[model samples]
Target: MIGAAWRRTLNDDRSYHAINLNEFSFTVPIYAYQVEGEGGLSLIWSRPNRD
Candidate 1:
């Protein structure tokens, strides 16, 4: 695995979130969303778009 995260629940939406530690030693916020009909969660992490 590239990195690991500590799962947590949100108080507002009751959704899951975490802080991702990448292999490069950078920490980024990641969010977990439930997949439709799959009964699974997908982690999403992205950087701000600069145009």
Candidate 2:
């Protein structure tokens, strides 16, 4: 899971400032590894390990 946040200012009245974030979440790889092979350096990604 990943999150993004930003600060925003309202345009009404006294111009209130507020903190805002994404209402929806995105799924992304959490585990990654680098390997050296015949093709040179490579990157591999996998799911989180529970153990």
Candidate 3:
């Protein structure tokens, strides 16, 4: 099984400030022979427009 999740952070203006993420999680049967690897994970941020 494979899955992903996400989280969001708010700024002082009560707007979206940044997005946090978790890498995909996988589950495999014991008999299945497989090699697993991971890549760089990152967070994206944006500034809120205050009018």
**How well is each residue in 1-51 modelled by candidate 2, as lDDT tens digits?**
242323343454322222222223423334444445578766554554545
Clashing pairs in 1: none
lDDT score for candidate 3 against the true structure: 0.30
Clashing pairs in 3: none
Task: Encode model 3's per-residue lDDT on 1-51: one tens digit a residue.
Answer: 332333333454332223322233412211111222254343343333433
Best by TM-score: 1
* Candidate with more favorable, higher lDDT: 2 or 3: 2
Q: Which RMSD does model 1 reach against the true structure?
A: 5.2
Candidate 2 vs. true structure, TM-score: 0.34
The true-versus-predicted C-alpha distance at residue 36 of model 2, in Å, is 0.5
| TM-score of model number 1 | 0.36
Q: Estimate each model's TM-score.
A: 0.36, 0.34, 0.22
- CA lDDT, every prediction? 0.48, 0.40, 0.30
Candidate with top lDDT is 1
* Residue 28 alpha-carbon offset, candidate 1, angstroms: 9.4
Q: Per-residue alpha-carbon lDDT of model 1 for 1-51, expressed as tens digits?
A: 454656455665464545444444534433333322355666555653434
